[model samples]
Target chain A: MTAEFWNGTMAAAAAAKQARVQVNAAYPITPQTHTVEYLSRFVNDGELDARLCKVESEHSALSACAGAAAVGARAFTASCSQGLALMSEVMYFTSGMRFPVVMAVANRTLSVPVNIWADHQDTLVNRDAGWIQIYTQTVQEIYDLILLAFRIAEHEDVCLPALVAYDGFILSHASEPVHPLDQAAVDAFLPPPGSADRPLLDPARPLQFGEVLFPDWYPDFELKKHRALADSLGTIRKAFEEFEAASGRRYAPVDAFATDGAEMVIVGLGSMMKTARHTAEKLREDGVRVGTAALRVFRPFPAEDLLEAVGGCRTVLVLDRDIGYGTGGMVYPDVTRILYHEDHRPDVLNFIVGTGGKDITPATIERCVELARGGYRGRVEFWPDARGAEEGVPYTEEPAAP
Target chain B: MPNTHPESASASAGRKLHEIRLAGRGGQGVVTAGDLLGKAAVREGFWAQSIPTFGPERRGALSSATLRMGPEEILLKCSTAAPGVLLVLDPTIWTQFNVTAGLVEEAVLVFNTTEAPEEVEARLRGGALPYRLGVERCRICTVDATGIALAVLGRAITNTAMMGAFCGATGLLGLEPVEAVLAERFGKRASPNIEAARAARDAIRWRA
Candidate 1:
C-alpha cells in the first residue's frame, strides 16, 4: 500500500492492529493517548477485532495485558512517564512471567518539576527490568519496530515482554509518512494468534505462572531471565533480517552512517539520531571527518555493534536525552565500558541534551561536535553548561489571540 | 533565553526545505492547519512533518505549530529555528509576540488582517508590537482570512484561509493538493473551507 501520513502513535496503533493484537489494555496519557485512542477507533469501526480494555490506571492496564497473555492470547499496551512508572511493578512481573506482551512507550521526562516533554529517563529507569527495549528514530521505525517487537518478544527462544520507545511529542505527535504493511504481510511475518507454543494457563493443562519462589531457586530463575535476555540478541538480529527481507526496510541493532575513517562521531538514540546524522552530513560537506550512529536496541545493549559504529573515530560525542544523576547520562557508562577494554578506543563524551523537551536541533549537535573537538574534558556536561543560557528561549509567549 | 533561533541551514545545504511556523490562539485549529499543510506536501511526493508545541490545555491560550517539508526526508526533529514562512491566523498576535522571529531571507510572512499591509507594518513599527520583527528580508502577504472564514464557514477559524494565502504567496504547493486533502478530511463540509481557502488565495495582497 502507498504511504500515508501518520504520527508515531498512529503508526504504532496501526502495527498493533495489523499484528491482530488479541487484547489492548491501556490508560490514556499524553503523547501515548493517541496510540490507544487509534486502537479504540479501530475496535469501534470493526477494523480490528480486539478487546480494547478501558482500564482505570496504567497498573491495571498492564495487569490486564498480563492476564490476557497468560491465557495464550496476544496482548498490547502503552504509556509513558508517570504512567510507565505506575506500571513498573507489572513491567517486571510481565517479563518474569514470560508473557511476551508488547508495549509502546512514548518516552517522556519524569516528574517533580512537572514536565510533559520527550526524554528517555522513563525507559532507562526500567532498563534492567528484564524486558526487551527498542528505541525508534522515525515514524516508520515506530511501525516497523512495534511489529518486530511482537515477533521478537513472542519468539520461542525469547518469551519476554518488549517495549518500543520513541521520543514523546517528537514521535508521538509529529506527522510523517509511513508505509503501513498489508494484512497479508503482517500475517506472514508473525505467527498466527494462539500459536504461542509455550506454557499457557490452559484449564485443560494445569500450570502456574508467577508462583512464589523460594530463595533456593530464585537466583537460578533470575539467572535464567538474564541469560534469556542476552540470548534474545540473536533472536532480535534474526527478526531484523527477516523483516528486511519481507519489508524492504533494513534495521540493525545499531544503525551507523559515514563512520568510515571519521575522526569525530556523534552518537544518539531515538528521534535525535536523524538530526545528528543531518549535522554530521553537513559537517562532512565542509571536509570535516564526522559520522553518526543511532543505538536502536537498548536493553540488549549491543556492545559489539555500538563499538563498531564509533570505535574507529577519534572522539565519540554521545547525546543522551536522559541523565542517571550521579552516574551521568544513562548511555554514557554503557559506551565507555564497551570501549574501556579496547586497545584502540575513542574518547567518549556524554552531553545531557534535549531533556524535558529542550530542542536538540542540528545546531545543538554542531555545538556538541565543537565541544568534543575542543578537548573539553567533562564526563557529562550539560551542552550549554547552563540551561537557558545557550540561545534565547526558542519560544514566544503567544498570549490569547484577540 | 539564548538566541537559539531554529537554525536554518536549508539554503546552504542545497535542500529545498520549506519551514513554516503558525501562530494562533488555542481552538483556532493551528495544529490542524499544520497537519493539512504537511499532508498536502506529502500528496505532492515531498517529505513533510508537522508538530504542535502543546502547552497547558486551555481555550484561547496562545498555541503554535511548526511544519517542515522538502523533496528529501526532513530529519531535524527540533522546532523550526528559521522558518521560511510565518502564518499568523490572528492579526493581534503581532502585538503580543514576535511572530516574525528567525525568518529566512526572502521569507513569506502571511497575516490575517482586515487592514492593508501598510497599516499592519505601521502598527508593527509604531511600537504597538511587543517585539521587533527581527527578519532580514521577507515578502509580506495580507489577507482577510477571518472575514473569508466567517463569510464561507460562519466561523473565525482562519487556518484553511491562511493555508490558501500561503500557497498563493509562495506557490510552493498547488491548490489541487490542498483542496484534495480538505475534501478528504472534511467530507461534505469541505466546500466552505475550500472556498475560504480559494478566496483568501485570490485576495492576498503582497508587499516586498
Candidate 2:
C-alpha cells in the first residue's frame, strides 16, 4: 500500500477527494480552514470533480451544501464554534429533509468572551438538530469515521446528514500517524454513486419538501422526524459492521476500554477519551478498578450499548467537556434519562472537564476516578474545580526538573 | 525505546531512514521545520511527509510538527512517541510536557538556546536523554531570515532560518537538495533565504 502522512485536516480532505464529493460549501474559520483549503486544492488540481462553493457565512455554507445534496449529489461542508451555532437552523432542516450530506466539525468552545479552543459546547448547543453526531479521539479515527459517516448517513433507512467532530487543536491540529485506506480498497468498499434515478427532489415528481406547517400538521411531521431518527440506530450499526468487514477497523456507538469487571467507569467522547484511556490504564495499574467508555456516535444515543458497557460497574463518571449552564453536564442529563427507567443502573456522576481547550491530563482523570471511588454521589461534579479553573492552572510540578 | 524491526528478511534488507519531531510554541516555525525537512528529503529522491499540530489560536500555545523519511513507503501514522530526533525550539516545553518520555536511546536532541549541553543535561537530571545540539545565537538567524525575506521576498518569515538549522544539524539530505527544495518553496525570494539558511547551517554546533 502506498503510504502518505497527513494531518487531521489534510486526511479529511483526502478522504472526501477519494469519495468523489460532488459539491463542497464551506465558510473560512480557523482550525477548520485546512480541510477546506485542501479540498479547494483537490478541485483545483483536478484530483476531485466537485463544485466548490464559497459562501457568505456558515449558515449559507450548510444551506448550499443541503441544497446540493437535495439534488442527489454527494455534498460536503465543515464549520466550527460560532459558525456551527450560526448554521443551527439549517442543520435541522438538512437532516429533516434527509439530504445525507457529510460535514466535519472541528469541535471548539462557544464563547461570549470569544475563546478559540477545543470544547464540545458549540456542537452540544444544538444536540437536537436532527443530525447524526460522531466524535473522534485520534487523527486516524477522524479519517476513518468521516468515511464511515457517508455510509451511515446515506443508508436508505437513515438518510440523514452526519457531522463527524474532532477536538479543535487537540485532534485537529495534533499530528498523528494515520493509515489512510488505499484508493483501490476505498473504491471497492464504496462503489461510485449508483444511478441518481432515485430523485430525492424532482420537479417531475412534484413533491413538497420542508414546507412550513401550522400546529395541525406539525405534530405528524415531528413524529415522522422522530421515527426516522429512531430508525437510524440499526442503520448505523449495520454500516459500521460492513465497514469493519471491509477496512478491518471496528467501531461502536459506545466503545469501552477495560470496563469488564471494573468498579468505576468513566464515559467521554472525542479526544478526552484518549486521556481517559491512558488514565484508565494507569488507574488499573494502581488497582483502582477504573475503566473508560467513549461514545463514538452520540445522536441516536446508544442507550442499550452504553448501559451494557457500564452494566456491572458500581460508579459511573460521565465527563463532559461542555456544561448545560445551571443544569449540569450535557451527557449527564442523557445518561440520567436512560437510567431513570432502568431497574439496575450504576451510580451516575457527572464531571465537566477541559472547557475551551483546557488540558485534561492523566492526573485530572485519575483524580476523577479517585472521587468516584470515594463514593462522591453528587448529581454533578465539575472536575478539579466547578468554575473551570482547572483550565489555565499550571501543573503542580514541572514534568522535567529545571 | 527499542526499535521494532519485522523479522521478515525482505523488510530487514532495506535501508532505514530517520523520523524527527519538533516541538515549540505556535509561530516558532516548528511546522516549517518539518515541511522543509520533507521537501529536502523529496529533493533527495526519498519519500517524506510532514504533519503539524496546533490549536485554533495562532500564538502562545503548544505546537509540534513531525517529519518522517524513508526509502520505502512509511505506514505508521501515529505521533512519534519514540522520536529518533527531538528538536525543541522553546525550553518551556521541557516543563510543560512529557517531551522526553519516549525518546529512543540513540535519538538526537536539538535546542535553540545559549545553555550548554551539560547545563541542559543537568537540568534533565534523572532522565537519560539523547545527544544534544545547542544553536547559540539562534535569534541572529531569525533576524537574518527576516532581513533576507524583506530584501528578497519582501516579508518577514522565519521558516527559512528554521529550515537552515534543520539542514545544518541533520545533513540527512545534503545542502544541494536542501537548496533546491528551498528554491521550490520560496521561489521569488530564494536567494537571500538561501544565503541565510547557509549561514544558520554554519551556526549550528553539535555538543562534544
Candidate 3:
C-alpha cells in the first residue's frame, strides 16, 4: 500500500472507508466535519458503498448509528467537545447495550465561553462508560487505531462499543503521512462485523435493546459489564498484536520511548505525546535523561504497564490536557495512585499543557523538566498560553468559506 | 527562551527543513496557502507538515498558519513564532499586531503590497506602534499580491500570490510544484490562482 499525506480527520475517514463502515450517521462539527464530509463525498462519488445519515444533532447521530448497528451493520460516528457532551446520554446507552459501534472523537476543550479547540476533557468525560477508549497521537495512529477499533469492539468476549480520540486541530487539521491499508487486507484482518455472535434485531429473532430491568437485576448486569471491561483489556492487547501482524504497525496500550534506564519520564496522551517524545530526545543531548510514555488506551487504563514505564525513573512529569477543575489536572490522581505503594515514590509533577488550542513548545517542556528537578510542591501548573483576553467566539462580518 | 517556532534547528544543507509562517485575517486563504505549500514541498520529495492556528474561526479575525518542510522527518511541532521566512497576506496586518513579533534575525519578509519594499518598510517604521522587529538585518521583499489577486482572482485573497513570493524568496520549491499544488487544491478554479502565483513569483523583488 502506498503512503499518503493526510490530516487526522482525512485519515480517519479513509480508514473508515477501507474498514467498510456500512453506516456513518453523524452530525458535523468543527474538527470532526471533514471526516463525515469525506464519507459523504465518497458515497456521492460512488467510490464507497455506504449509508450517510445526515442527522441534525450529535445525539440523533449516535442514536441513528446505534439503530443501524442493532440491525447488524458496521456503524460509525464522530464529534468534538460539545457534540460529545450532547451525545453522551446515547454514548452510555450504546455501551450498555453492548453494540459494537465504533466512534471517532476529535478531542476538544469544554465550553463555558465556547472554545472549539483541542483537549482531552471531551473524550474523558464519560470514561466510566462501558466503551473501550483509544487515543491516538498522529494521523497514521488515527488511521490504524480506528481500523483496529472495530475488531476490538466486536470481539465475542468483548462486545462493547469503542471510542477512538485524537487532538482536534493539532492532529485533525495538521497534515502528515499515513500508509493506506488495502481493503482486502483490512477485510481479512477484520471479519464481517461478527453480528451473529450476539442476538441481533432480525425480523425472525427480534430482541429489545436498552431494556428496563429491576434494581436487583441491574446491579448484576452492571457487575457483568465491569467484568467484561476488565476482560476486554486482554482482547485489546490481542487485537493490537494481530493488527501488528496484519499491518506491520505495532501499537501498544502505552507507547513508551527511551524509558529504559531513564531518570525522568514525561507521561501524556494524544498529540502532546509526540511533543514530549521529541522534546525528550532533544533534552537527552544536554545530559538530561528524559523518557516519554503516551497512554494509547485510556479506558482499559493500562495501570500495570504505565507504572512499569515510570518505575525506573526518579521523577514523573505528567502533561495533561484535561483540567480537573478544583481537583487539579484529571490525569494526576489516576497516575499518582500508581506510585503510592513505594516506600520512596518518585516525585510526580503535574502540569496542564496545550489546553484550549494553546501551543505546546519545547520551552514549556524544558520548563516542566526544570520544575520536576526542583521537585513538585503539590501544585498543578498551567503553562502560559494564548488565551484570548476577550471571551466568546470571535465573530466577523464575512462568512466562512466552504 | 521563547521556543514556539514550528521549525527545529535550521537544517544542515542535506537535512534542510524550511519553515514559513503566513499571517493574515481569516478570510485571506492563509491556511490554504500553508497547506498547499506543504503539499508542494511533499511533491518536491520532502516531508512537510502544516498546522493552522485554529479557534473561533471567524472571517476577518487574526489568523496564521505554520508550514514546515524538510529533507528528512520534521518533528518540531508548535505554532511558528519565528520562521525562516514570513509571508503576510495583508499589508496592514501590522496595524493590528506586530506581524514581525518573533521574526528570525535574518529572516525574509514578503508583503502583499503594490508599494516598493522601501516604502512598505518606511510605512511600517512610521506606523503608530513602535517597531520591535529586527532592524537592518532582515531582507524585505515587496509584491503587489493584492493587486495581482484582484486582477487574476477577481478578489483580494492574496494567499497564493504570497506563496509564490515565498518560493521566489526561498527557492525551496520552484514554479512547477507551486502550480501543481494549486491545481490539485482548487481543481477547476485553479487557473486564476496559478496565474496570480506566476505573476508574484516573477515580479517579487527586494529593496537594495
Instruction: Assign candidate 2 its CAPRI class.
Output: incorrect
Give the per-residue lDDT digits (tens) of candidate 3, residues A1-402. 224778889999998898888999989888899999999999999888898898889999999998888888889999978899999999888988888899999898889867888889988777887889999988888999999999988888888899999988888999876777788899889887534387678889878888899997999999998888878989999998999999888989999999998899998888878877878888999888999999999887888889889986888888888887777677778788878886658878877777886677766677677767765464455443423312441211211211
RMSD of 2: 7.4
C-alpha TM-scores of all predictions: 0.94, 0.76, 0.90
Error of 3 at A371 (Å): 1.3
lDDT for each of the candidates?
0.85, 0.72, 0.81
Worst ten-residue run, lDDT, model 1 chain A?
A: A393-402
lDDT of 1 by residue, A272-376 (tens): 999888898899999989998898998888988888877778998888898887777888878888889999978788888888888777777777787778787
True contacts kept of each: 0.59, 0.06, 0.37
Predicted structure with the largest DockQ when compared to the true one: 1
Candidate 1 C-alpha lDDT tens digits along B1-208? 1111133232332358788899888878899999998999898888899988877867677778889888788888877878888889886776787777677777777789988877777676676567766654566768899899989999999999888887776676768899999999999999999998888888987653
Task: Please write out the lDDT profile of model 2 over residues A205-232, one tens digit for every residue.
Answer: 7777888799999899899888888779
Note the DockQ of each predicted structure.
Answer: 0.41, 0.13, 0.31
Off by over 4 Å in 1: A383-385, A388-402, B1-15, B125-127
Better of 1 and 3 by TM-score: 1
User: Given candidate 1, what's the lDDT at residue A145?
Assistant: 99
Model 1 residue A57 CA deviation in Å: 1.4
